[model samples]
Target: MLIDFLEFMISASNDSYIFLAGISAVIGAILPLSTIIFANFYEKSTVQTNDLYWELKREVNNSKAFIEGFNKIIYLGDNREIFNSTLKLFKLISYILILLWVLVGVGYIANVSKKPLDSFIISCSTLALISLLIYLPRILSRFQRELPIKVENKSCSINEIYNIFDVKGKGEDKLFYEEILVPTLSIVNTNSKLFIRYNQNLPLNNYKVFYSIQNKNKERLFINIGLLIKNKDFKNIHYTIGNEVSNTDTVQNKFSSIPFGIISKFNEIDSKNSFIYILDSLNQILYTGEVKCIFNSETKISKYTIKTYIDKSPNGHISKLLQNNEKEVHLLDDQQKLTPYYLLDYN
Candidate 1:
């Protein structure tokens, strides 16, 4: 009876030991198995992220390059109509391609044969990525890249610009001398020769006279020109403050007041031409050997005088010119000479 009990106890102990060993082995395997699964998830996620980044970057660059190239064609070739048509074609194609990509990616993700939870995760992620893919091109169209996309234009040739800068008139008449004030301060023709200056006591060579004008055909923003002497040129200019304003009504807070008239240095041009000018808002003809001229540009202030020849006046009277309250008005006698006193200011 004792021997039977001992055998039974030994068998029970052995079974218990086996059960404990099996439980310990399963516990040990649980951690490694979980670790392996997590590692695989991380690897897959990393790959997806990398691919997404690269793909987005590539698409962005390609879109910008395409647009930039198209603009170059318009600018350099003067083929703006053709450029717009071609670019519109590409824009349509890209739009169609993006729509198709979204449809496929979304449809596959929604109905694919996979675990419901996994499908949900992948669907959300891919939808986000694909949605970005769909909108990325549109957004990238607005995005300016760091890389400079230079497009040269079919601009007015240097020769043409130079010739215009020479200030030709109805004939090849000489138009300048010492000092000239802006009539209205409008830059009508950038292609033509223009100069704006405040003839202060600065070295002629060192002082940079800043001015700007727009292209008549293009109507671009005001582009600045550097200091030009009797023979100089400017290009690749930037925006800066000046003594004058732009072609538009937006006034420059600095140096707002423009001179009422202009005085020229050339005597020969004055005697020969029937040109009239302003001095302190006074309309005076080029009657003297010292040419007194009125400067004219597109930019107009509140009240001002224009520079041109008016054949009606036998002698352009300085006193008749009254641009604004800023100037004292002078009148003319029946004899067409300067009145003894200014008409408006004597009182």
Candidate 2:
């Protein structure tokens, strides 16, 4: 009976040991699984937070850059139309967002529950739209108020009408000083002979000059010439004109004869009655005047002269002439009474 009791105790102890080992194995598995779940949750939360921070930072940088570009445009007084249009577009988008917010709010209110996916989306969208509408227009309005400062900063203006003359090409054999000044003969028949001058104190770089003529039937003839007037070599822009056509032909073309080729295109569309226009690079007309064709029936030739009277001014004038038709404006030098100012002459 004692031996039987000893075996039973030993079996009970072994049974207890097995139970403890099972409990320890279960605890070991459960602890690692719990730790893994907690770690995953922590990592996901950290990644989401980092993403939100970066997105907010990027949005802030984009806003700052946009404001800077707008300010630069205002300061330069360039591309104002594009800037205004873009600002208006943003304002319109803000208004649209406000409308969307109102619609979403109505949807949320009509549905009594705020726990659905629809509720979450509507809430977030409404918040964002409300924020944009509250601030966009006031910012744009501030920029619009600064338009007067832009206009005040503009200093480029055509001061007066300078010189007007006709350019005539003599045969290669004709003497230089003996070049004839028969204005009546040159003006009536040739488009190659007319020249007009401008007295702009500004450089010719990025300046465009227009030549237009209207016939009796109301047909318009127009020519636009763009100049690259440099400050260092403004008086010697004949080289610039030559450079415009330098790529066309062989080296046989001389500098003095280059004007003829430049005027070749002008002569193709040339007219006796024409107008000269001065414009900024933006095609804004700074000044304009007429070239009148006076026909002499007895001589059977049209005598051409620069029309300076206000009544006879050409169609493209944005400003009036500082001097009248009778006054002569010299260019480059005061004593050099015969320098031709028209592009067709110098070219």
Candidate 3:
């Protein structure tokens, strides 16, 4: 069918030849323009940089081995060199094909004008151009893989806020509570200030902390606390846990600190204690810590302190799920240790 079409084009009258040349000229012009348009659209579709890229960029700059491996894999290595060479070759061939098509159209016009010498010179360009077009699809079929520049690792930490208070008996036997120091939660991040925010992938349902009050008889009272970290600018890295307004059912700004108070009966004995267990969305324990409460019977006061003591390292399933075979990227903080009350000292 292609051979018959070429023969028909060759045997056509001068006017018909000119018309065919006009069509080829339009196609020659449109091919590169269409390619440029598609390239622009694809560039716009893929975002060049994001937070993950910036984070990785900082780490890549600090590690010599990592930077060397990354560049070799993504940019400066043999794979990239070969791809770049192939890209240049195909672009050169496409340009030659386009120029040859223009020459052929000009030859047809020259033939119609009765200039055989110019017609022959232009017609000679056709053989190379036709051969290139026949093999164009094969060369153009190869695609390149772009190296990834982003990595995201989500982590959560649980810290306890300690608040101390003094209690005194009033003249009418009424008890008055005095705030000594407001309890504030301290979230520990050694290398980066990355904290989990409720708005991001960190959801309130993923974790819950429990507080309890136990008397001498071992009777216990329990309270549930939800995790909600909030801040005006997420980039600032300083975040505070949002306090739930009692009974109003509305979220409020962070209080002076995480505050809890206990009122014992005139001679009742009780010990207040709290502990937090960090969990993923699937309810798997990631970390657990204790919040100690010290009661002062002589001074009629109490002290509450929380410290994370242990972190359950990733199990086999979690490690396998987070691993990617295509690229070797560092995501785990293996050196990170769970400390008791680390956030309190982290000013």
For candidate 3, report its TM-score.
0.24
Provide the clashing-pair count of each candidate structure.
7, 4, 0
Give the C-alpha miss distance for residue 108 in model 2, angstroms: 1.5
- Which RMSD values do the candidates have, in order? 25.2, 26.8, 19.2
Candidate 1 local lDDT, residue 219: 19
Q: For model 1, how does the per-residue alpha-carbon lDDT over 1-347 read when each residue is reduced to its tens digit?
A: 99875444334333443454465357335633443344444344434433443343343325444334323322433332233343344346445544544444444444452577776775576466456434634543332221111122332222221122343222222122112212222211133222232222111121122111112121112111222232221222222222332345343332243222211111112223322232211222221121222334344211112233333332223222322222121222234343221111110
Pitting candidate 1 against candidate 2, the one with the higher TM-score is: 2
Model 1: ten consecutive residues of lowest lDDT = 338-347
Which residue ranges in model 2 land beyond 4 Å of their true spot?
A: 1-75, 112-134, 145-347
Candidates sorted by TM-score, best first: 2, 3, 1
* Candidate 2: 10-residue stretch with minimal lDDT: 176-185
- The candidate scoring highest on TM-score is 2
**What shift in Å separates residue 218 of candidate 3 from its native position after superposition?**
19
Comparing 2 and 3 by TM-score, which wins? 2
How much RMSD separates candidate 2 from the native structure?
A: 26.8
lDDT ranking, best first: 2, 3, 1
Compose the digit string of candidate 3's lDDT tens values, residues 237-328.
Answer: 23322232234433322333232221242113332323333333344443344445554566443443343343334333233322222111
Deviation of model 1 at 78, angstroms: 1.6
Tell me the lDDT of model 3 at 250.
33
